[model samples]
Target: MTGRAATRRPGLARVGATLARAWRAVSWYVKEVVGENDYEHYVAHLRRHHPEARPVSRREFERAKLDRMASDPGARCC
Candidate 1:
């Protein structure tokens, strides 16, 4: 490879390592907060905290969630 290409190798390696660390942190947080159960309890928790979370069909919830995700980059779908 050329000199420039060789120079970029370490930068790419550092970026890859940073991304791996971030992914691991997120994975650990999810496991600790939500455990391995389905999302029903979390939904219920939300309803308890904010009584406005009335019952809605699963299909509608999923559709709205997907739409929000498509429009908002900051939204987390999981």
Candidate 2:
């Protein structure tokens, strides 16, 4: 391998490690804040806070959420 490529290896590895740590942190935070089977509660909280927001069917909401996550990795659940 070229010396330049060797030098870049550690930086790439560090970035991968940082992303892994961030993913774990986010997973833990989600579990703590909204464990499994809390979808209804979450939606209700959203409704309470934004009374003007229109309601969405469960299937539509889930599909929209999945699309948002795919399009914006940093998007948060509302």
Candidate 3:
């Protein structure tokens, strides 16, 4: 490869684009697996079913979720 062939850069651009897409897919999968999008779903649900209600912050949502899980006093803790 020489001159025009060696100077071609589309291959590098394609590799970078592929890597960016792969990173997005992997991050989305991890977030879904770990419930990272739960807050967004909760807000959507509130808007649909309880439009008059206020949506809680992510911190509050997580705290309430943990509290609910802990309320099963006789259940095994994870």
Candidate 4:
């Protein structure tokens, strides 16, 4: 290949890698901000630390979390 073509390939590869890393970071940030990944982490934790315990479904977990937050006055701001 020519010099220009070879340089373009490396530049393209670097751009692709940078985009992939940025996408992953943004994806993770969105999930955490929206609490979407909480259950996934909870399930993983249960599997690793409490093999005999059953994991809560996402709906139930969300419901319980809401109830707990509501009951705890300290969890909210006036």
Candidate 5:
């Protein structure tokens, strides 16, 4: 292969790596914004602050969070 062809591959590889990193960051941001990370955080909190306590499952955690938010009027933006 020619010298130019060899160099072209490295450039394409760098572009692909950059795109992968960017997509991962975007995916993480979307999950955070949509509260998909809440269960992970809750688990961590329980482990750190209340190791003896049993953490609820994801479905129950979400259901309780929604119930609390609905009952608390101040939890809304508008």
Candidate 6:
């Protein structure tokens, strides 16, 4: 427990914490940008708007979305 060693530990911990926050932010941003969170949003919407109904599985939701998009490719990004 020298002065330099103690200071380095705190500084390194701060940097590590900062990096963790930054990584989480980036991960969330990428998920939002790429619609990775769509199923979660869909489930929430269903719960809000149709509480009596059960939400579809993620795979089914994605498959139906893909089918819709395939029928109208122009509606999506190039």
**Reference-based lDDT, residue 51, model 3:** 100
Model 2: residues with Cα > 4 Å off, grouped in runs = 36-78
All candidates: TM-score: 0.44, 0.44, 0.71, 0.75, 0.83, 0.86
* Worst ten in a row by lDDT for model 5: 69-78
**Each model's Cα RMSD:** 12.3, 13.4, 3.2, 2.3, 1.7, 1.6
Tens digits of lDDT, candidate 4, 1-78? 698898899889999999999999999999999788988999999999999999988999999988887888794576
Candidate 3 lDDT over 39-68, as tens digits, reads 999999999999999999999999997897
- Cα lDDT over the full model 2: 0.78
- Give the winner by lDDT: 5
Error of 1 at 61 (Å): 30
Candidate 6 residue-wise lDDT, 1-78, digit = tens = 598798899889999999999999999999999889999999999999999999999999999988988999996788
Q: What is the lDDT of residue 2 in candidate 5?
A: 100
Can you list the residue pairs that collide in candidate 3? Answer: none
Model 6 has an lDDT value of 0.94
Off by over 4 Å in 4: 1-3
Pairs in clash, predicted candidate 4: none
Q: What are the per-model numbers of colliding residue pairs?
A: 0, 0, 0, 0, 0, 0
Number of backbone clashes in candidate 1: 0
Computed on alpha carbons, the lDDT of every model, listed in order, comes to 0.74, 0.78, 0.88, 0.91, 0.95, 0.94
Model 6 CA deviation exceeding 4 Å by range: none
Candidate 1 per-residue lDDT over residues 26-71, each given as its tens digit: 9878976764323465578778897886766666666776687688
The candidate with the higher TM-score, 1 or 5, is 5
**Poorest lDDT segment (10 consecutive residues) of candidate 4:** 69-78
Cα lDDT of model 2 by residue, 1-78, tens digit? 699999999999999999999999988788767643345756788799988877687777777767877989764665
